[model samples]
Target: MQETERLAEVRERIARAARVARRDLADVTLIAVSKTHAAETIVPLIEAGQRVFGENRVQEAEAKWPALAERYEDLQLHLVGQLQSNKAEAAVRLFDAIHSVDRPSLVDALARAIDREGRSPTLFVQVNIGDEPQKGGCAVAALPGLLDQARGAGLTIAGLMCVPPAGVEAAPYFALLAKLARDQGVPLLSMGMSDDFETAVTLGATHVRVGSALFGARA
Candidate 1:
């Protein structure tokens, strides 16, 4: 499908899913995950009214952000992948929100980077709800301490972000994330993706990152 048609179709899917979940369409924000696609593909989607986009790599984001920003000043870029502490500087410079901050060193680096840039973007602490050590997130048990530290450091802690375990059911993990968000007293819950966004929305997800569902295969 052409980009315009694809954009409309994705919006319709969001609306339909919201209806199925009995949630207001306005309450669910769609983030186009434009990670590996070229600028040519992204620009059409932007022109089609997709203001929010997601990128996985700090380096890739750093390279594309300048051009995207120049062409689409209203674009809101989100860093959706595991962010390394060393890449924090470039990540802060390019993204409007960082969704994978799961370590103290990463948080500290982000604080310093934001301080240097004089811009503090919204941050979401990635929680390894399934307790996957290989993942780059705090284990669920450690979230409170991390949340306290991030807040004490004056990082704009908007809410929690999580990626449910691939093989396991997503509902329980998502519910746990919602509980964590409530306990932390944060409002935003960035969860859900193409396959399970309806469940995420039903569980109070404020933002759903949909890529393949919208843009088809990642080229």
Candidate 2:
């Protein structure tokens, strides 16, 4: 399908899913995960009226988005991958929100970066909901301490984020993340992706990151 048609279809799916959950459509933010796609590729989605986009790396986003943003100034870029402390400043400069804050050290780095750059992007603490060591999020047991450190450092966390184990049912993980977010007093739940976003929305996902479904297969 054409990108425009796909955009409309995805929006409709989101609306339908939200309605079934009795949640307002406006409460859910559809983030087109544009990682690895070039500016020429993303421009069509922008023209299709997609404003919020996700990038997995700070360097790749730096290479592509500035040129695109010159033409599409209203775009909101989100950093949705594991962030390195050394790149904190660059990530702070490039993204409107960062979703992979999983440790106290990162909290310190981001706090300093935000202070130095004078820009406070929305922050989401990623929880390793499955306790997967290869993953970049904190363990569920360690979340409270991490959230406290981030807050004490003056980072107003937007909510919690989680990437469920691949090839497994994601609803349970999404529900766990939502309950933890409520327990922590944060409002946003950045769960869900291209495959299970509808389920995530039904479970209280305020933001869904969709890629191949909207942008086609990545190069």
Candidate 3:
């Protein structure tokens, strides 16, 4: 019941934010990030009207989603974390969308996987917005070529995804990512998390991956 209320509250907040920004609420897709939490906990949110979910790991999602997706009618799962070249086949086979398509190697892997399996998931090229050494996205400058590569390989290049630097105001990063997408003529911007999603929507984020605010703090 508590999860249901939280889901409603989050939806209301997203709707209000979209209204304030003069954007249709239907245009924004809220991805309930279900990383670390079990399927039992996610069922309530699904019952409460959340059809989209994001997971950080292929193994963890594979362990849980096969059964959950079998039971649920319209569930959409997205891989929203770093994806390894080795797991491209599994990720492509299991997920409806992949938000961490970052590097040339992973791109090659996914292309082959898609060809072999006869399936192509919606692909988002993650850009390392902060340019931090440890993060997983391609450099901002490399986006065009990477996008070209994915498209050339016949993959469905959905849009761009990013995670801004921690402990800093994220609006600029989000805005910059949105600009990059527009400059390149890409249609979707997968930005924002639980904290600044409303702000991201105001700046034209089509998809927001929210975790904590929806599922509560992870242990």
TM-score of each: 0.93, 0.98, 0.97
Clash count, predicted structure 2: 0
Which of the predicted structures, 1 or 3, would earn the higher TM-score when compared with the native?
3
What's the candidate order when arranged by decreasing lDDT? 2, 3, 1
Candidate 1 lDDT over residue span 86-145, tens digit each: 888888888899899898998899889998999888899999988877777898888989
Instruction: Specify the poorest-scoring 10-residue window by lDDT in model 2.
Output: 36-45
Candidate 2 per-residue lDDT over residues 107-194, each given as its tens digit: 9999999999999999999999999888889999999999888889898999899999999999999999999999999999999998
Per-residue lDDT for 78-100 in model 3, tens only? 99999989999999899999999
The residue-level lDDT of candidate 1 at 98 comes to 86
User: Which candidate ranks first by TM-score, i.e. highest?
Assistant: 2
TM-score, cand. 2 vs. native: 0.98
Stretches off by above 4 angstroms in model 3 are: none
